[model samples]
Target: MPIPPVILAGIARMGMTPAALIWGGDTHQELLCGYIAAILMAFSSIASYLPQMKETGKLGFAAVFITAAGNIIISGQQYGIWAYGAYAKEGLFVDITGMLVGIGMMLGTILLAFVTFRAKVFPLWNVLLFVVMLVSFGVPGLESWFALFWGLAYGAMGFTIVSGKYRNKEAAAANSLNLAS
Candidate 1:
């Protein structure tokens, strides 16, 4: 899907450098490199699942593949194009502000996970909430490490559920028997 112009503009605003540190490079190249890295990660996750694909329900596995593939395509294209635009100004405040936002997001994800686990329910709405949480925190002026990590966490949650490994032997045994006869 084509990204909306507003989001595209926002992506363009991100550029290569954060608010601090002058790491010089061709902006387009940096964006492309980052995009490739993310894509590689997504495919690697899929490849890792090759041995256990059938045991995992196809519906859940397909959802994971879609999430990973979609995230890479959207993020890569938007950021790749945006890097060609302006870079942000550098300062202590900028760095600190970004770091704080990243920390907040990381904490928020933890809180959400905690609540879900304690409630003993992994609802689809909860997953959507997590996705919303990631997008809200994934803006520019944040630490890339934190942004990417949360983004990944959001994606991985789907895989965890679909793999059926999250459940005890009761569920797995039932599925195995169902598959057998």
Candidate 2:
């Protein structure tokens, strides 16, 4: 989560949308990294939902699902494959699909962050980082490097989850599970 451009640089997540690749330079490494980063991004976005649901209830649940939907769309697209490989020029459908998925993913991520903020489960800084990462559209010439911050934001959250740093809800979750058992 902290990041990897091709691996640890946050896997080259240029724009999380095929539209970004339209300007070209979608090489094998770039495509591979982008896809991988996108997958991680989706998972990272969804991870915040669990803790929030306890505090915000259905509102949090909705955000989680929406974010997941968007992530799934971004992950499932053939944008990377289409942009760099043999089928690069085959059809317009693929690009259009990627673009649409990007839109959904953007909305999902934004909503999820909002609910998580309301829930107050994660650290304030981490939440802010995630929000910033989600909304930071790159400037005209600096798009390639934008993934660094995104990676940092997600990476930090990943670390937080792993360390159980601010996981107040998880303790309750464990007790609830034990009671059920």
> Largest TM-score belongs to which candidate?
2
All models: lDDT?
A: 0.43, 0.58
**C-alpha positional error of residue 49 in candidate 1 after TM-score superposition, expressed in Å:** 3.2
lDDT of 2 at 171: 49
Task: Assess the local accuracy of residue 118 in candidate 1 as a C-alpha lDDT between 0 and 100.
Answer: 39
RMSD of 2: 5.4
TM-score for candidate 1, please give it: 0.35
Backbone clashes under 3 angstroms, per model: 1, 12
Q: Candidate 1 regions off by >4 Å? A: 1-30, 51-55, 75-143, 147-181
* Tens-place lDDT digits, model 1, residues 2-106: 542222322332332342124434355446544544454444434323323344445435544554555455454436354545443246754675555445434
Tens digit of lDDT per residue, candidate 2, span 87-159?
6535788668767766765666666667667766677777787666765654565465556556666666656
lDDT of 2 at 115: 66
Q: Highest lDDT: give the candidate number.
A: 2
